[model samples]
Target chain A: EAGVTQSPTHLIKTRGQQATLRCSPISGHTSVYWYQQALGLGLQFLLWYDEGEERNRGNFPPRFSGRQFPNYSSELNVNALELEDSALYLCASSLGASGGYNEQFFGPGTRLTVL
Target chain B: AQTVTQSQPEMSVQEAETVTLSCTYDTSENNYYLFWYKQPPSRQMILVIRQEAYKQQNATENRFSVNFQKAAKSFSLKISDSQLGDTAMYFCAFTTMEYGNKLVFGAGTILRVKS
Candidate 1:
């Protein structure tokens, strides 16, 4: 299996700008998860998309939003990016949203640097 | 709402030795899922192990194992016979029974392995 794959390994944007990160889930996976890992911090849940619907979102502001496509791929968009937004954004995929039993596979992640 | 905590910010261990990372989460849900993820310098998040709250047996994956205490809300990861490649940032996460739930992650612990 190829596992999960993300695009544009690195992205740079200025403060107040917008950034878009893309991810392709593993084959046969129907759930995609977005997470943000700021320097020296853990992975913070951003959003969860399954079956082309926004299932859940994190405590992050509305500026952090994303969607899942028909193919189960996902895109994470950060609007009004702040310097603190510089971090690694990861995408993970699972068979479904059935709690712990659903094994999740992650991608290399897109490193967004907000200047 | 749930919160995960990793008390150790950083830890180092010599090759062939063992190291344990601590994690604790608070949640009101009776059933949930917990996981440990490893993010290497390449920034790829890999699922290290998982433990279901309802299951008393600890989850293990080869050299990686977890000590899960449901009542205490504690889940710790122990790596036996660690190698230099074990260096990475380890994060503990939680997911509740609520449909389409998002993961709650800890601050993470940085593990460094030395030869």
Candidate 2:
């Protein structure tokens, strides 16, 4: 089966602009997760979407929001992007919330560069 | 809230040698999950190994293994017969049922395997 896939391997946006990154989960997966790996902040959880609902989110600001489609694909939108928002945004997927032990497979992250 | 810490910011190992990356986590939840992810220059996050907090046995995958200490709240990754391909950024992560699918990740350790 194909692993998680992300679009726009690289994205460039100016400060105060908006950016949209997309992710496609693996076949048969129902849970999608978004994470941000900033320069020195490490990998931080951004959002979790399962069964088309937002389950949980990290301490990130409301400007960092996303949604999951019925097909389990997800899109992360950043409004009023800032220089600190430049990072590698990664997407991961698992079986679902029921399978807590299921491993999450990740995508080749989308590198967002905000100037 | 849960937090994961990787103390070693950078490390190096010779080919065919063994190297261990240390991680410590703080969580009150009795049941949770720990993971080790590897990201090469390609920037694709790969699951290296996983350990369930309730499991007494450490998890091993090929040359990669984890030494999990529940009481001490320590989870370390040990790579045996290290290879050049193993050079990458290694991250330690934690998650609990209460947190849903949100993963708390460490600052990450950059491991360079040399020939």
Candidate 3:
């Protein structure tokens, strides 16, 4: 089966602009997760979407939001992007709830460069 | 809040040698999950190995293995018969149901395997 896939391997945006990154989960997966890997900040959880619902989000600002479609694909939108927002945005997927022992498979990540 | 820490910012190992990356986590949840992810230059996060907190036995996958200490709250990755392909950024992550399945990742350790 195909692993998680992300689009726009690289994206460029300016300060105050908006950016949208997409991710397609693996076949039969129902839970999608978003993460931001920023310099010095490490990999921080952004959002969690399961069964077309927003389950949880990290300490990121409200400007960082996303949604999951019925097909389990997810889209992360960043409004009023800032220079610090430049980072590799990754998407991961799990078979279901991902609460217990489920393993999350990740995508190649989308490198967002904010000027 | 749950936090993961990778003390070694960088490490190197000769081909056919072995190296270990240390990680420590802080969490109050009795049951959770720990994972080791490898990100190569390609920027794809690959699952190296994972261990369930309740499982006493360490997890091993091929040449990669994890030494998990529940009481000490330590989880370290051991790579044996290292190869050049093993050069990458290794991350330690933690997750529990109380956190809605979001992963808390470490700052990451860069491992360089030389021939």
Q: With candidate 2 superimposed using the best TM-score fit, by how many Å does residue A36's alpha carbon deviate from the native?
A: 0.5
lDDT of 3 by residue, A10-95 (tens): 99999999999999999999999999999998998999898999989889999999999988899999999999999999999998
Task: Give the per-residue lDDT digits (tens) of candidate 2, residues A1-115.
Answer: 7889999999999999999999999999999999998987888889988899998888899999999988889999999999999999999999988856578899999999999
Q: Which stretches of candidate 3 lie over 4 Å from their true place?
A: none
Residue A70, model 1: Cα distance from true site in angstroms: 1.5
Report clash pairs, candidate 3.
none
- DockQ of candidate model 3: 0.87
Alpha carbon deviation, residue A84, candidate 1 (Å): 2.2
Chain A only TM-scores, each candidate in turn? 0.94, 0.97, 0.97
lDDT of each: 0.88, 0.92, 0.93
lDDT tens per residue, model 1, A1-115: 7989998999999999999999999999999989888876567888888899888887799999888889999899889999999998989998886534577788998889998
lDDT of 1 by residue, B1-115 (tens): 6789999999999999999999999988889899998888888788888888889999999999999988898999999999999999898988875735577889989999999
Pairs with backbone N, CA or C atoms under 3 Å apart (clashes), candidate 1:
none
- Candidate 1 ranges with C-alpha deviation above 4 Å: A98-101
Ranking of predictions according to lDDT: 3, 2, 1
What DockQ number belongs to candidate 1? 0.69
Q: Which 10-residue window of candidate 1 chain A scores lowest in summed lDDT? A: A96-105
Compute the interface RMSD for candidate 2: 1.0
